[model samples]
Target: MNPETLLLMGLGAVVIIAAARWIGARTGLPAAALLAVAGIVYAVLPGPNISLDPHIVLTFVLPPLLYSAALESSLLAIRANLRIVIGLSVLLVFATALLVGAGFGLFVAGATFAAGVAVGAAVAPPDPVAALAVGRKVGLPPRLVTIIQGEGLLNDATALTILNVAVAAAVSGHFSLPKAAGLFVLAAAGGTAVGVGVAYLVRLLRPLARDPLLANAISLATPFVAYYIGEQLHVSGVLAVVVAGLIVGHDTPRSGTGASRLQTNAVWRLVDFLLEGIVFLLIGQQLPAVMRGLAKYQTSTVVIAVAVTVGVTLLLRPVWLSLTQAAHLLLRREDEGLNAREIAALSWAGTRGVISLAAVFTLPLTTGAGEPFPDRDLLLFCTFVVVLVTLVGQGLTFAPLVRRLGLRANEVDEARQRNEARMASVHAALERLDDLEEDEPGDAPTIEALRGRMQERLRRYEHRLDVLQSAESDEVPVSEHYESALRIQRLAIEAQREELLRWRDAGNLPDEGLRRLERELDHEERVLPDRRE
Candidate 1:
């Protein structure tokens, strides 16, 4: 592409992305899907077609996107659900590939077992970006979100490994189960080791930088380095990027200065936004091409493939979730566990996306005899159909399902926890303030004022907790009077927030002051009953 064409494409992408977001917000569809459709429409036009090289996309775009997703994910949450993550990431991918591939080989005409497995592996992993974006909008339970993200992050490696093996076997006209299994283990272990090692080195070098921006730049380059190193060593690049992201994200605070932390976060956020936009837009652009490919396949074949893929993707999730939950119960007798609501949320949230598309596009174009690969276009078309059906169909219905199931954040439980923590912190602060007041009598007025503010905040917390607890017990009936009081409190908090914003705009308030006040407003808003519900 020429520079002028590239410039136009960049500008068009931005415009399309913005419009997609606006439309999605109004219609409850994912902005990614909308952006993708726009890309497809643009591609079908007569002028200057944009063709993306699979190698450039897999090497350049994917590493950063995966790293960003991994960085934003909470390590603690992943650790908590380690078993579930492992099961979904490794075991589920293998099972899905085996079953789907076997079915295709046995049933579909002109499809070999190797090609079938390759396609299955390509479509096995759900897209983390799509799932999380839609899941948050639908208010999926935090635990479910964690599991989905965890699986999404790790499954890419498994799928990619399987894909490589399948393609190699197809090209070489040979297969070795033991060799493939060994390669999988080696790639995973090697990738993880390299990633963690690179992360530690980055941490060590971070403190040597005087400028925060420079430190942030080092953090940005680490993922690319990890990925390249892993690929050079014949390891799993996906796993390498993911592990590196997690290590740096979790350990950055210890190695980074305050300025470094802020700069790093800002850089990652910008990178995340741009890459996410590009991925979704590419999805839209590929749609026309996919449809054209499907033209060669018989209508009945296309229908059968679409029906089977969508059905398996949707139904497999709920079955896996139920089985996982049962296993968790057997293994651990903990009081806290994922309830049915969470499992339901997980079942509905399995939306396939970019990874599947990228994998399909990366398939080899020729078989062992140097003849053209069979059903290559058909495989890509079927994969796209799976993504569209799951993303648009499930993404749209997710929120309504949540409401029907009465699945929302348990505010009463949250408030009780917050109150307990706040009460303890207040008591500790009060003791410290008492000693300080005695030591500095001249500053007693300031201390007393601070003490009074803290006391008032404590009282508000207690009042909110009491209301929630009482409401939970059904001792206090819903009252118009309480509702009115909540409305008034909301208005007051809104006014206070505006005042804080004004101070921020005028440079009269520090960042900390604005953040603290905003947090207070958020807490108050959360406790306020949802009138809409």
Candidate 2:
């Protein structure tokens, strides 16, 4: 691309992303969908045609985006949902691919089973970035969000495995079930091992570096190394990146200084934002190309195929979720499973994005006999149609569904539990300070001051809890007292945090100590309920 064209695309992406973010906040529609729409509008209008190489996109855009997603993901939550994640990510994807492919091959088009499977694999996995973005805005319960994201992260590998096998079958005019299954296992194992090895190596090297910037830079390179190594070993690069990210994230406390951690977070956040914008924009930009390819088929036929594929993708989630929930209940008797609101959120959060586009674009343009790939254009067109429908249609309506289902967090209960925890902790700290005052005569003034602060914090928590738990008749007076106490606690925590930062800067405390204190303050902030009514 020319500099001017590149500049324009960049500028357009900024405008679209900004507008999308604003609109998404107001409407609860995913910003990605809006970005796609904006790109499509630009493509359809009179302007310099900007086309991107699929290889360039796959190599540059995908790696960073995937890495950023992995970094932000909570490994603890993911591990907790491993069973559900595996079921949806692997088994469900395989099932969906086989069924959808068979239906297409036998009924819709005069294609081989492998060709149908290819299409199925291409569209199977939901986009994690899109789903999580919309889900957070729609107030999806934390557990449901974990399940969706975990499934989304892993399903790409399953779909890709199926796609590779199908593509080989299509090329060689042969299919070996045993061989394919073995390859899938080998690839997964290879990726996981490589990721784990590289993650440990990165962790080992991180602490030797003194500068925060150097450590942050080393962290950045780890993902690409994991990805490239996996690819070199003929394994799943995506999975390798994910595994590496999880390892590093879990081990972050070991290597990262507070400054380094903050820097790394900011860098990844920027990378993620830009990549997401670019990915959606590219999806929209490809519409014209996809349409040109679909010109060979009757418009009605193409429309029906697209509609059926989309309907299957949308309907399959709820059906599968119900079955999964039923099985969980039978096996574990857990009532904490998804509620109706969460189920609805899951159903609507299934938006397709970059991975589907990458899979479609990666399809071969020529067949074994040197002729054009059979129905390649139709496949791309259908994929685009499905992406557009899910992103725009379901994305727009998700928030209203959340509101209708009354899925907001229980603020009163949350605040009360937080206050109780704070009261207990403060009481413990006061006792500890009393011991310190008796042990050291010279430190008596400092210990006494600390005890006074702890007492104040204890009173604040007590007052807040009392207000929240009070009878309605006394609520007004209790609430006023609670607000006053809360303000004092907030100010105290802020001051404490500031003092800790100064101590670290003055070399009076280690970076780890400051980080631990910061974490405590952050926990306090989370516990303090949003007072915005």
Candidate 3:
């Protein structure tokens, strides 16, 4: 594409994304699904359409998306749900690939087992982005959200590893189960080692990255660095990026100044928003291109293939979740099993995204012996169709289903926990100040002032806790005293900001000096809730 066309396409994608968001907000539908449908609509009528470059998607796109999600993810939460994550991300992927492959060989004429497995692997992992966007908006339970996040983060590695092996078998006409298994173990272990190494290396160099700009720069590059290291080592690069992100995110509080965290988060949110919109739009735009090659296959064969792929992708998830929950009970595990409704939600959340399309699109045009790869275009079409069906179908319904099932998280209980914790922390600070007063009698007045403020905050937090515990609904009542304090604080900050502006306007302060002071005040003002609202 030329510069002008590329610019136009970029602009068009943003417009579509904005429209999707607006529509989704009003309709309670997923923005991703809307963007994709918009792309498909544009694909049929378009003067210009963007084709997905598999290498670009995998290298340029996948790393940052995975890394951003991982960074937002809680390491403790992921660890707590590690078993469910592994089962869904690893074991379930393997089973889906093998089962789909076997079904194709048995049922679909001219479809080889290896080729079917490759397609199966491509579509196995649910893209966490769409599900996550909707789940968070709809207030999914914390544990279920964690499971989805952990599975999405790790499943790409499993699916891609299997896809690579399946493709190699198809190309070379050689297959060894044991060798493939060993290769998988090596890839996983090596990728994990690389990810951990990269995380520690970043920590060791934290002193050099103390400058907020420098720290954010290093943070942005860490995922790509981890990806490259894993690729060079012939390991799972996706896994490497995710692991590095998780570790880095876990260390973020202690890794840099408060300024770096604020800046880094803002940057990542923008990146994620743009990339996700562009990606799903790209997925939808591929439909016309994929279908162009479908002319060579029989209609009946194509339909059968699509049916098998989509059906298994949708059905296998719920069944697997139900069976696993049952097994948890049978084995007497510590986890309280998921009820039917939770299983239903998890099942619906298995919507696929761009990763599946990217993997299938990466299929080589020809095998090692110079013959064409069997059903390459067909596989691509099926992959695209599967993404469309689930992304739109499940994405559109997931929110309302959550509401219908009444599976939203208990916000009242959560608020009470937070306020209780805050009360405890404030009490601890008061206790420490009492110790300080004994050692530093010269600062007794300052200590007393601090103690008074701490006591006041403790009282406010206690009042909030009482409101939360007694509230029957999600809304927690704020104390009038707390509201008044917040208003006074805001008023004082505004007065200080206006005085600074007066100094700048009167030529008493330089622009740079004014900006520095403004930033400090801006950060402080952001620390409280608005009382007027």
Evaluate residue 447 in candidate 1 and report its C-alpha lDDT on the 0 to 100 scale. Answer: 96
Instruction: Assess each prediction's global lDDT (C-alpha) against the native.
Output: 0.78, 0.76, 0.89
Q: How far off is residue 190 in model 1, in Å?
A: 1.1
Alpha-carbon TM-score of each model against the true structure = 0.80, 0.83, 0.94
Model 2, position 478, has a per-residue lDDT of 39
Ordering by lDDT: 3, 1, 2
Model 2's alpha-carbon lDDT is 0.76
Greater TM-score among 1 and 3 belongs to: 3
Model 3 ranges with Cα > 4 A deviation: 474-509, 529-533
lDDT winner: 3
Pairwise TM-score winner, candidates 2 and 3: 3
lDDT of 2 by residue, 239-319 (tens): 888888888878887776776777688888887877788888888888788878666787666765676567678788888
lDDT for each residue of candidate 3 in 410-459, tens digit (9 for 90 to 100): 87777777777888899889999999999999999999999999998788
Candidate 2, residue 504: the lDDT equals 93
Could you give candidate 1's per-residue lDDT for residues 1-533 as a string of tens digits? Answer: 78988999889788877787788889887777676667767778877755545677778888888888888888889999888788889987877776667767777777777777778888888886766777777666677788888998899899989888988876776656677678899999999998888887877886564478788778778778989999999999889999989887787657767656766777888887777878777776786667766767888777766665666667777888788788879989563566788788777777787778888888877876888777888888888888777766776677777778876655456556666787789989989999999999999999999999999867865765666667744223345655787789889999999999999999999989899889778866875755322
As for candidate 1, its clashing pairs are 36-284, 39-285, 40-284, 40-285
Give the top-scoring candidate (TM-score): 3
RMSD to truth, every model? 5.6, 6.0, 2.3
